[model samples]
Structures are given as structure tokens and as C-alpha cells.
Target: MVVSTRAGAERSQNITVVRQAPPMSRTVSAAGLGAVGGMVTEYLFDPELGRSRRARLRDKGVRLTHGVRNGTRTVVRDVRNRGQGVLGAARYRTTGREADDEVLHERVRAELGRHVRHPREVDVRVESGHVTLTGDVLDRESRRAHRAVARIPGVAGVDASWTTHHDARRAPRSREDGGPMEALQDLFRQRWSPAGRSLTGLAAAVVWSLSGRLPRPLGYLVRAGCAVLAARAATNLPLRRLTGIGAGRDAIDVGDSISVAAPAEEVWPVLSDYGLFARWMPDVLDVRRSDDGGRSQWRVSGPAGVPIRFEAVETAREEGRRIAWKTTEGQLVAHSGELSVTPEDAGRSRIQVRLTYNPAFGAVGHAVAKIFGADPGRKFAKDLMRLKSLIETRRAPVGAGAGPRE
Candidate 1:
């Protein structure tokens, strides 16, 4: 049985409190808590909670205790931040991104393949963003690893203390710069963009290419015009179309804002992975990107696996931060656009997507007036949630501040 005394919204409950030491309590050192939470979670208390409380937390939740050793501060800092920043850290919190990353690194490493302790050679890997430093340095080679990482291009920066162990003072040499483990992480980053073929946006577009009231060839033209107007319309988005201009290539407007716990530099690698679409952006099907050469494609899929008639091609491409694509199958519609990311204030960046697609059929064969539509507005809302998830999950060195954008 449970009993509670309550006044207003504050409630003190008399319930069976399982006063057991939490699993990570031993690793949650006082210093770790302070590093991640500024000087919090150091005090001892009764009734330590478990991660099982995930369901009960609203707005936030936490489970903390302290007894870390060695890199105690690093361990405890990550434990306090065991979930998203909103998830809370009993005494103090950030987000468990650092902890989560450690778990991930250990999990998919070799096979996947990663580092192992031995007596001959020691290999160190430091993954900051875009670049991964994988090479062999001597024992406690951490300092040497940082120096190497800083010299690598395409990398924003490296966490100085990141390194691995070995038994030999003199190793032949690392096979290449980074191994398969670093490759996997970097590979995924490349595939995460929104502008590529085989993307969810392309899939949704394919689904809708045949959806709605307007008919294509003619309808495509309508959709294209609408899409152009929507792109130019707003930076924030209300996208309430004034009239129900029939579809084909109707303009679409998607607005989003995502907050991350670290600075912009840390957040750069994560954002660099994505391009410009939600898994639900209607009409196009498969979007794939390739920097090996200057070629990218957006393939359309229909009722089943069948390919539709619409596919977009990239006419111009930049390795990082920018991409411009165009399709001139103008019989039905023509699609043209560029996605640009500009760093905003507070370690954050603003993603601006400018698109101009011509929807077939108009009074004089020219782009025309607009109307207020509501459904696309709702989808944009859902997309914002997804971006928030991706950015907040980016990992960094334990104890060091998360350079994520808040």
C-alpha cells in the first residue's frame, strides 16, 4: 500500500521506496557530476532510483549516485546524462550523449572491428566530426593521437584524451589512417543526407506523385508552382495556403528548429550527415548522393516497387554544406533547388532550402497565385521532432563539454 501527503502540485508520498544502490551509482563520481552538471549531484541521499523510471518522468527524470574511480569524473558525468538532456540526472544533468557514445563505440567496434588491449601495438581512434583518426601511437599515446587528429582535414576537432592500449613500444605502423570501425561511422554520416536518392523524402514524393486531386503531366505543373511559392514564402512557416490550387507540383514549405546541448562545432558533424527531407516528405521516392563523382539522383517509386516517370538529377554539387539539383522533364514539371546551412547564434545553424519547381497547367503557362493549405504544415511539425532526436544524440568525449548547439 502507498500513501501520500499533497498540497497544490507538490506531493510527498509514503510508498515502498526500493532504497537499493543504482547500477551506475558506483561509477557516478562527484567530479563527473560536477563536470557535466556544474556542481550538482555530489550530495549523498537515500532512495536511489533506477533507469526503470523512464515511464514516470514527464518533462524530465533522473537517477544518480557517486563512487567513481580513475576517470571517475568522466564516468559519472556520462551517467548523470544517461538520456536526453530533458531526461534529467537526479542531481544534475546534460544529455547522456557522451555515455551513449561510449556504449555505441564498444558495441559496433570490430567485426565491425575496433581496438583491443595487447602487449605489442596500441591503436587510437578519435572521432570528432567528418574525420576519424585511426592510427597507432605508443602507450598512453592519447596526447600523440590528439596531435595527429588536429592535422587531419575535414575534421572539425578531436577530443585530446581519446586513445586505446597496446603492449609493444614499437609497432610496424597502422595499416592506413582509420580502420573499418571509423569507416562505418563516417559511412553512415554520408548516407544520412536529405538530398540523396533512396531517401524517405523521395519515397513520400513518389507516393504522393499519384495522390491528391490534380492529375500529373497537368497536375505536376500545379505542384511545381505551389512548391516554388511555398519555398519563397516563409523562414518560420505558417504555410496556410490562401486557396486550394489543384496539385501537380504544388509548392511545399517545411520549417524546423532543433536544440542540442553542445556548441555548433560539435553539432556540425551530425548536421553534416543529413540533407533536406523527412522520411515523410511526399512525392519523390528514392534519393541517393555520391561525391565520388558529380552525380546524384532522385528515383521515384510507384504502387509497388515499380519506378515512376519522375527522377531528379543534381546539376551542381559541393562536397560539404551545399547541393544544387535540377530536373528538366518539364513536360509535366521542372524541379530546381539548393540546400544551404548557415551557422546561427548559440552554437546552432539555420538550414535554408530554396526550391523552385514548375507545376504544369496555368492560365497562361506561368507560375501563379497561392492558397492556404494545412496538411503539409502538420507534417512539418513531425519532421522537426526527428531533427531534434538526431542532433541531440551526437556523441563527444566524456567530461569535456558537449559542443552541441543548445
Candidate 2:
């Protein structure tokens, strides 16, 4: 009986332990949620930039709501139009009615434009539902063009006549001759275009829906794809630009300008000389130019005395005016920079520097660097000001050293 009583006591203890587990888990989850809430509150209600941040958030929310509403309306309208087209096609088939000669000609012409690479070179004419294609055409495109025109809703027959060239270069028509859809595709490939955003947004929605129905690892991949599509749709930026793959005029990550008391000619010498950079440029410990004068290796003092090294090749130089350089291949960081000197009144010169960089971890690395006061933009601004002072005084600025300037 004592043993039985002991077992009952143990059973009660087990029940108590099981009952305690949920409350502990709930407490932890609540604490986590509270921490997240506090962080979000601090981020949106900072002392200096809170108002602007909140306003920006509100504006973005409004824009997103509007975008969703407009996209829904557009989708509904397209569905309605497609349904009408289907119904019309059914009616025509049932009645055995044919389109008018003018309508047929227009349809054939449109089909030719869609199928032919050099639509301008292919002169299309249609009479009584018969399409006649004439003029210079590429042999590769001729069969497809004939087939496309023949398959038109109102086309009765197609007659091909003509000159066909095997090589596009030898063809009479210029390579730039592309149809309407091709032109639209070119525009859609650009960074931000209306058509691109619309198509990408639609694709994102489709992919997002499919992602939920997919299984396991494939589903995870589809989810990632959906995220990429959604980001592209919202930002209207190409994958390369969004990820900071290559440097271009549009990829300028940091830029600043300073006015110097010295003439452009005088400032040009100091700026162009890579050896002089370490003296004025903040955190730049050493710079060594190649014998050919086209490439230079740079060592900049990073956080905790760590050295950041990279090699750059001068891509272009216009004496006393502009200079440009880009990092060599296979570097941890991809970067390019351009400096231009413009003369102003009273022997003053405006020096502008533009730098583009794709560092490790992309934007996250950039943000972390900024938080650590290692942002190149901030350094560039400070360095330019120091350069201005150095040029004007003909001496090194106070506090200029091998380490970063305060």
C-alpha cells in the first residue's frame, strides 16, 4: 500500500511537470514577441529621424494599397476581355462566318509583325483572306513567317515570293529592325519600366501561389524564387543591379563633391597621383602604383587595425579633367571610382568623386559597415575635405595619419 501511494505521488509530480511546460514556453514566446515589438518601436520612433521615418512608412503603405487595388482591377479586366474573345470565337465558329477582307489583311499583317524578325523588310498584302509575303527575308524566318500568317484566324492562303539570305549580316534590312513585341521586351529588360513591373508583379503572384502547393526542398526553392520575383516587381530593378553585381553609371553607390581654393590644373596633379592619396585620404595607409602606371595596389586601415587591400586599374584618364578606375577581377569586393575636376571662378575648382562598390554580403555588409563608421561614402567626404585643406595650405591637414581620421 505504501508503494502504491508512492507511485500515485510520482504520477501527480509528472502531471505537474507536464502542466508547467506550456506556461514556460508561453512565457518565452511572449518575451520574444515583446523584444521584437520594442525594437520595432525604437526603430520607428528614434529621437532624430522618427517623424520622417513614420511618414515614409505611411506613404509606402498607401502606395502598396493602391498598387494592390489597381493590379486586381487590371487582372479582372484582362480576364473579362479574354472571356469575351472566347465567346466571340465560339459564335464565329458556330455561324461559319468569316471576317471582312480588310480585317483579314490587318490580321495577317499583325501576324507577320509578330513572327518576322525584320518585319519592315517583309511587305505583307492580303486580299480576299489570302496573304502574299514579298521582299527581302531571311531564310530562317521565311518558313516561320509563312506558317504564322497562314494560321491567322481569317487567312485563307499564303503566297511566299522572294529573296532570302542565309546570313543576317548580308541581309538588306538592318539588324535593328524588330517587331513591336521585341521592342516591348527590350524595354521590359530595363531597370524600371511600367510593363516590366506589371509582368513581374503578375509572375510573382503566380509563383507565390505555386510555392504553397509544392513539396519540401522544392517548395523552399520556389519560396525563394517568389521572394526574388516580389522584390523585382516592387523595386523594378534587374537582378544584377539589385544584388550589386557590376558597376555602371546607374550603380553609383556613393558620391560627393567639394570646392577647393586651388585651380583645376593644380588640383589635378595631386588627385591624379596615386602615391599622394595616402597622405590626404583618410585611413589609406599605402598605395603602390604599377610600373606601367595603369594599375595600383591600395591598403586601407580597417577596424581594429585590420588592413583592407585591393588592386585597381585605371580605365580612363583625361588630363586635368577626369580619371576613372575599377577593381581587378576576382577581388573580394568589386568597386569602381571616377573623379572629375571642373574649374570655377577665382582659381577655385569643383572636384567630384563617384564610387560604386559591391562588397561581401551585398547590402547587408554595406549597412553593417555604415554602422561601424566604415562606410566609404563617409570616408570619401572626409578625405575630400582634407584634400581641399591640404591643397589650399600646401601642408598635411592636422590629425592626418596612417589610421582613420576622427
* All models, RMSD in angstroms: 30.7, 7.3
lDDT, residue 240, model 1:
23
TM-score for all predictions? 0.28, 0.63
Off by over 4 Å in 2: 1-19, 23-26, 32-133, 143-158, 170-181, 184-188, 194-215, 244-253, 302-305, 367-380, 393-406
Q: Looking at candidate 2, what is the lDDT of residue 210? A: 76
lDDT of 2 by residue, 1-406 (tens): 9999999999888864333355778899999999999988998999998899899899999999998898778766766776797898787556533788787777766666766777777777777777787888777778887777776676678889857888777877648546434334523575554445666677878887877777879999887887877776676656666666553333337888999988998999898888778888867788899999999999877657788898989999999899999888887547788989999999999999888777654554565677776766777778888888888998888888647654
lDDT of 1 at 162: 28
- Candidate 1 regions exceeding 4 Å error are 1-284, 290-293, 300-309, 315-320, 330-333, 359-374, 394-406
lDDT of each: 0.41, 0.77
Following a full C-alpha superposition, what root-mean-square deviation does model 2 have from the true structure?
7.3
For residue 268, model 1's alpha carbon misses the true position, in angstroms, by 5.0
The lDDT, on a scale of 0 to 1, for candidate 1 is 0.41
